[model samples]
Target: MQRGYFFSAEGGEGAGKSSIVSRLSEYLDSRGLEIITSREPGGIAIAEQIRSVILDKENTEMDGRTEALLYAAARRQHYVEKIVPTLNEGKSIICDRFIDSSLAYQGHARGLGIDKVLSINEFAIEDVFPDLTIYLDIDPEVGLRRINENADREINRLDLESLAFHRKVREGYLELVRRFPARIVKINANQKMDEVFEDVKQVFDRFLVSMGKLS
Candidate 1:
């Protein structure tokens, strides 16, 4: 049996990543595909524990390199405990976030250097990479506004970051898209959620067709 495809969604804060992941998962499920959805830094129990430390608003004293390492550690645990097993079962998976988030947030925004962060993640993930990444492109200001207006959304430590920091994160993600055009597809996320989902659906449909999973 063929190993299933691994897809990740990436973006800055409040880019509608969770919503998109949910819609995409449902769409794939309706097509009779065996699939699952997971998130980085918190998919499995161990990783979820790490996620709490990383996102805890009171942990403002966390060093930049330390933050990067924590993320890499969580990723390693998640990959071994959850992701690898799922793919081995021939079941496709959609992850809410993945290594790219590290490269963007810790790498670019934290001034740790993308290449350095990539090396850390390489050791953590052991070369397993996403087959495709759907990036929700949105203006940092607009995205943060959405976050502020959504009272139900959990405000993590990252959400408390300055606008300048979020801007840097978006810049980092855009750089990743430029570096990995074939693996990363950009979707305009400034529009209504329905419109954004349609754009994402088209990209997903084309991918299925290319794999001969659709007519």
Candidate 2:
């Protein structure tokens, strides 16, 4: 049986994760490979509802633990409803943001502690982790600046966080990279868009090569 591959794109807000993920998906599709691209807290009806609750501006009183739990809940639903089934059919899955986002944004930035948050997530999906993750590395200030300039984008509560919070989030991701060096690939997102896409393509190519899916 052919093993399925999961590629997760992660970074702070406005780090160009979505754009790069789209490009990567297009590239894979053009190659005539089976691919499924999706985002966390979504990919299914129930998960999208959960995402609304987490992103609602009126939910100011939401507790950190509550937010974490909600994310894990949505993630579980998405995994079961969409991700797992697609993978079982032998398709490559490219997801925008995954456990790392929670580990960095909630655990590190929100002071919840990575291990504590991870514990709940482990329960959520029974420790079904991604096979590969791509970390888009960029300075917090630059990322925030990009968000500010993108007036068409919807600003979330997290977008209002202080620069220090985003910095901590980035640091947390770096720590995760150290912990799972083999599973995570770091890409400098500060480069030009084309260059960033090229970096992502290189990493993905290597993954296919390793699996003997590419020459």
Candidate 3:
């Protein structure tokens, strides 16, 4: 029934989406809001298994269309098992990534075609798009540099892609802004992490205001 709002955060690697989502969920909790924070490709058990297959560096022979399909399969499980039920139960959700990642990574960067990837995702998400999508915009080089500094970070198949592919991912996001201008908000993430989160807060505050959750 979606008694509360859904917020999805989008960005390239090292854009600090996980940290931002955690902080926002904590803030909402402090404000007496029931907020659930999650991430895509593996939010629950079934989806986590699918995520592993998609991210495995050993799966170098995986086809582009296969990768996209795996993502869609995981997404559908996550939504049905976690997201939809949480929203229906009247809890707000903040997802670290969503269909937008596929549109950028598999669709555009992998040369699978944005429209093709989007069409595949449509069957899973079923038009229940995020009420708000906050995109953290940073140059691909800068973002990749940050990723390189994190040794503890899990190295996925996508992380091993050439810098050129990541740049295309960024371009794909920009194209998405043009496609869904009203729903996607761009934020400069080149600054300090705290600065980025402050911008996230402001954007979320506006959404809450619009929904009459704030005065």
Candidate 4:
């Protein structure tokens, strides 16, 4: 039997992860796979409330650790309520963003420390990490500009961070790739949407074949 997979699409702002996730899900669905997709800080009612508190523009006074804790709380709920159940039912779960986001944004960029953030998440998630993490690599300048130009894009608290901060976030992700080379794969996201998704498809094909899901 083909094993169900858990994949998380990750990147800094404007890296087009959300769009890529939609395309990835559609591609997987058409391939006759049972799949469920979700986004962090959400995909559940209680977690969605926590996401609001974290992303609220009015909550400017939120502390870094508080924000980190809130993210972990939401993630725990999402995983237990959505991810685990979906995976148990033998469906692939593709989450838009996951623990890596907290590691990059709150831990590295916000100066809270990556290991600390990871420990918090490890406690929440135990030994369960995504089966694979697809990193969308893009220059922060290009990504930010794309985000600003998109009418459908909504600015969240993280989006309001300084360009330099976003740069740090990118650097953080690169560091993570170095740390977990076996589990994370980086894809150039600066290409045109068509080109990017083509690259994404190739990556998915490779991963599926490797796992005996595709030949």
Candidate 5:
């Protein structure tokens, strides 16, 4: 039986992660690959409820460690209920975010330390990490500006963070790239949508070829 692969996309707020994931999933599907798309902290019913609590604007009093724990809990459930079953059936999945977000947000930006947060997730996910992670590189300022201009986007607790906090988040993501060079690929998201999509496509095609999923 063929094995299913996992793919994840990570970026700071307003980095167009949703759009990129959608396009990438569509691209993969067109190539006759069976694929599914989901998001961390909110894929299944239980996880979605946890997502509401984590992102609620009223949860301003939540502590950094508490936030990290919540994310891990949600991830645990999502992985067990959704990810494992899908992969077992030999269907690839494209997740909007994954363990990287917790590592960057709660671990680095929230000052909990990446290793500490990673340890928590290590138990939550039981070592099932993504096969490939696409990191969308962008200027935090530009990303925030895009968020402000987009009225349709939901305003979450994380989005209310100060510019400095968001910049730290970006730094955390960069650090992750440095540490996990083999599993993560960085794509410039500061360009136009078409340009960003093309870059992501190139990286994705390369990944497929490397995995022997494509010639």
Candidate 6:
């Protein structure tokens, strides 16, 4: 039996993660690969409810710690209810964002302390970690501009944050890359869509070949 693989794409807002994920899913499907795709704070009904609470703009009084804990809770539920089962079934799981987003957004940018946030997440996820993580690298200013140019995007509370916070999120991801050099791969998201797709596909192809999933 082939082993299941988890591929997670992460980056700051407007980093084109969604586009890349969508394209990758299409590419994988075309190759007859069985895969499941999802995003943070969601992918399951219970987790979706939790996502609402976290992203709701009206909840302006939510404490920072409360936010962090809520995310971890949602993640735990999602993993147990959706991700783990899919993997157990021998299908690839591609996630739009995972614990790294929380470690960066809440832990580093929101002043919650990375260690504290990671501890809560450790409890939530135990030893279940992604097999591969792709970090979409982009300039903060350019990313923000893309967000602004796209009007159809939902205005999450986080989207209104100052530039400094987003910068810190990028820095946090860079630090994570340094710490986990082998598992995380960085892709230049600033490139054109076709180029970005090629970079992402190259990484996925390499992993599949190494695992003998591709002949």
Which lDDT tens digits does candidate 3 get at residues 1-215? 54877889999988888888999899878766799988989989999999999999999999989999999999999998899989999998989899999999999889999999999999998878998999999898998898899898887988888889989999999999899988999999999999998998898888778877787
Off by over 4 Å in 5: none
Q: On residues 1-215, what C-alpha lDDT tens digit does candidate 1 reach at each position?
A: 88998999999999999999999999999977788999987999999999999999999999999999999999999999889999999999999999999999999999999999999999999988999999999999999999999999999999999999999999999999999999999999999999999999999999999999899
lDDT of 5 by residue, 67-142 (tens): 9999999999999999999999999999999999999999999999999999999999998899999999899999
Model 5 score (lDDT): 0.94
What stretches of model 4 exceed 4 Å from their correct place? 1-3
List model 6 lDDT by residue over 127-181, tens digit each: 6789999999888898899999999987787887899989999998998889788
Considering lDDT, which of the candidate structures 1 and 2 is the better prediction for this target?
1
Clashing pairs in model 4?
none
RMSD in angstroms, all models? Answer: 0.6, 1.2, 1.1, 1.2, 0.7, 1.3
**Reference-based TM-score of each model:** 0.99, 0.96, 0.97, 0.97, 0.98, 0.95
Tell me how candidate 6 scores on lDDT. 0.89
Error of 4 at 26 (Å): 1.2
Q: Which 10 consecutive residues of model 4 have the lowest summed lDDT?
A: 1-10
- Write down the lDDT of every candidate, Cα atoms only: 0.95, 0.89, 0.90, 0.92, 0.94, 0.89
The list of candidate 6 runs beyond 4 A from truth reads none
Better of 1 and 2 by TM-score: 1
Judge candidate 1 at residue 85 and give its lDDT. Answer: 92
- Please report the TM-score between candidate 4 and the true structure: 0.97
Query: Which segments of candidate 1 are over 4 A away from where they belong?
Result: none
